[model samples]
Target: MNYFQPKPISNFNATIDIPGSKSITNRALILSALSGKTITLKNILLSDDTQYMIKALRSLGNKIEYNESSKILKIIGNKNPKYDNIDLYIGNAGTAMRFLSSYLATGTGTATLHGNSRMNERPIKDLADSLTQLGVKVEYLNKFGYPPIRITSSGVWATSVKIDGSKSSQYISSILMAAPNFKNPIDISFIGKVVSKPYIHMTLTMMKDFGASFTLKENSINIVPKEYNLSEYLIEGDMSSASYFLAMSLISNSTITLNNFFKNSIQGDSKFLDVLLKMGLTILDFKEYSITVKGTSSYKGIQLSMNDIPDVAQTLAAVALFATTPTKVWDVENMRIKETDRISALKNEISKINGDFIEFKDGFLINPKPLEMYQGDFLETYDDHRMAMSLSLIGLKVPNIKVLDPSCVSKTFPNFFEEFNKIYRED
Candidate 1:
């Protein structure tokens, strides 16, 4: 097992550049492949998840040229691509698994979507049921309502469908991205309160940017059949990836400026800055395309619902270790189904450091402990990227904290440690 030892930094004023959004890159890849027009994407993230997405699109007969050094991608979209049979390994990429499930359903082909053991356990039944409702043939190859499933489609034949949105927003995004390929105009309605509502909005906004005609109401969305049109698109920096460095500022006495982070970012995780601000994090500068933040010597605990920004909830959990009071985060029951059971994982690791963590079905409460009382030689990452990155925060103040399986960060941020190491003093 590869272990990473995070050392405390004495001097940590630095500027860092984060990679493109894994969320946006995967979504853009699907949209570009369906556009039937050559599209250029700039500053796209080159990571395991996106590589899986690009490979799946290529396997579906879309021609794509990627320049890793330059982070540019050129995709030759194929609107009516067809395949006889293909097996795609999604490797725990939730976005790719969910997004591609619908993308494949909009084409004339038979495809099987499978993944690693963890991915196989993640739920895909809600998406499957919705596609089946739209007349797509969906079969559970192994356990019902999970991956290792088969999808055979001539195209979407239904005009309207209702899906349970409480589990994952990816289900809604999956159907929305594939709706334009439906035989008739589609109406999508939600059954319950949709978690991560901002992600659905991001999908609609990007669809409109690609020339899709859609109307979004309070509880339903109407989509018209139209080909996506876009010649060039520039992906924004991943705000979720930026959260670690932002949290780094809060743990250590330092200032960090992150490039390519927009003040008006459409990513839901960008709102993490607001949560940080509430914890006494200061924003030194906020511009259209960049943000500078300074750390505090002490932080205030916060109580709030993180359902909208669940991705950064782990970051907040780590930051809570240094808070003055107990931090309460709830309304993120979906955390149980991510790359790992984040709530349980966070609770387990926090206990190792003498921190008090009260678990709940939806979320947890974290009580701050004295830094001198912090004790733990190693923290298990559970093969989850967020766990590895977020738990490393404890090392910023505590001594000799080693994170096991740090390489798990390759899922979204491959060079997370490399960038994270930049804050250390050369001496």
Candidate 2:
């Protein structure tokens, strides 16, 4: 259970094929399930978060046949959805909880959407309140704005909603995904800043691809409900998942291949490549959907504002260690509400290495110029998968860097350490 130990290695170099994207995988799962058609999903991630979704879907009466040989997942649409009195446990995936909140609210039966301890702690009232405005009765089982929500779906509830977009895109995407049932499409207007705009775009694009109709302008999206013709949906590899390895080229100075990446991916995190590029990493396009990353012989610091793709903050923090100058990331407040308080966690742990970091109003600035190796110490992962995996990069170049709860990577990458060792082993 304690995977903590100092690992020291020199000259990290290897080509790695990262796992499927969690964001893309979850979207495909929900879309396939809703379309009531079998979707032959490719490169589905087999992490705990995804497995939790798969298991929950199976309980909801979806038959998923996974072919390990080719990494294809065949999700047999529910010929008869087993809503026969069951609670869908989403664990800690906010995406699962929010999207499903809007999704299951249209079901005929009463359903409960809930998760782990952290789930109840995380806010969902914004999403729940929006559902309620549309006649979807979402009652909080305990604390308001949190989970353990009770939803009793009647029919297609079409009511336009206006909400603050600065909160989270999952709220808006929730409305869009569940709007297909209304005789009148859901009309949503944003009241404040829209964070994670790319993800909202992704939802619209996916819905459009699946035959649903929608229009997005500025902060408003008009979704016209139509019967989506179910077909096989194959998702490209997750760029977020690939970011670690792509970043490895910079941190480890290795060549890594991230296969099946989409040039036009619905995943907002795909911008990670561009971010790394700004940091001086280059990609050699191998095939149409695959590329190899060759790091620049030298490193340069990049000061970026990560409001759009905030999830990569941890990786960027890790990447900062190799930069010639200090890297300052700003306006990433959303990182605080993720699996853990990421901003604080990043600062707390990074300080242990060299104690050379500063926290800004919304983000952190890492000064790796003073980074120095220390005695062997186990870095606690705080049950956050990103924190665990991101810390591993530091160990590649620094001695006595141990990672605790390395298994926490299963939240996204189940075989992270194994693959890490594989990509890092000396020839």
Q: Best candidate per TM-score, number? A: 1
- What lDDT does candidate 1 reach at residue 262? 74
Give candidate 1 regions above 4 Å deviation. none
Q: Pick out the ten consecutive residues of candidate 2 with the lowest summed lDDT.
A: 4-13
Clashes of each: 0, 3
Q: lDDT (CA) for every model shown?
A: 0.90, 0.76
lDDT, candidate 1, residue 164? Answer: 89
Model 2 regions more than 4 Å off: 4-13, 78-85, 370-376
TM-score of 1: 0.98
TM-score of 2: 0.93
CA lDDT, candidate 1, residue 101: 86
**lDDT winner:** 1
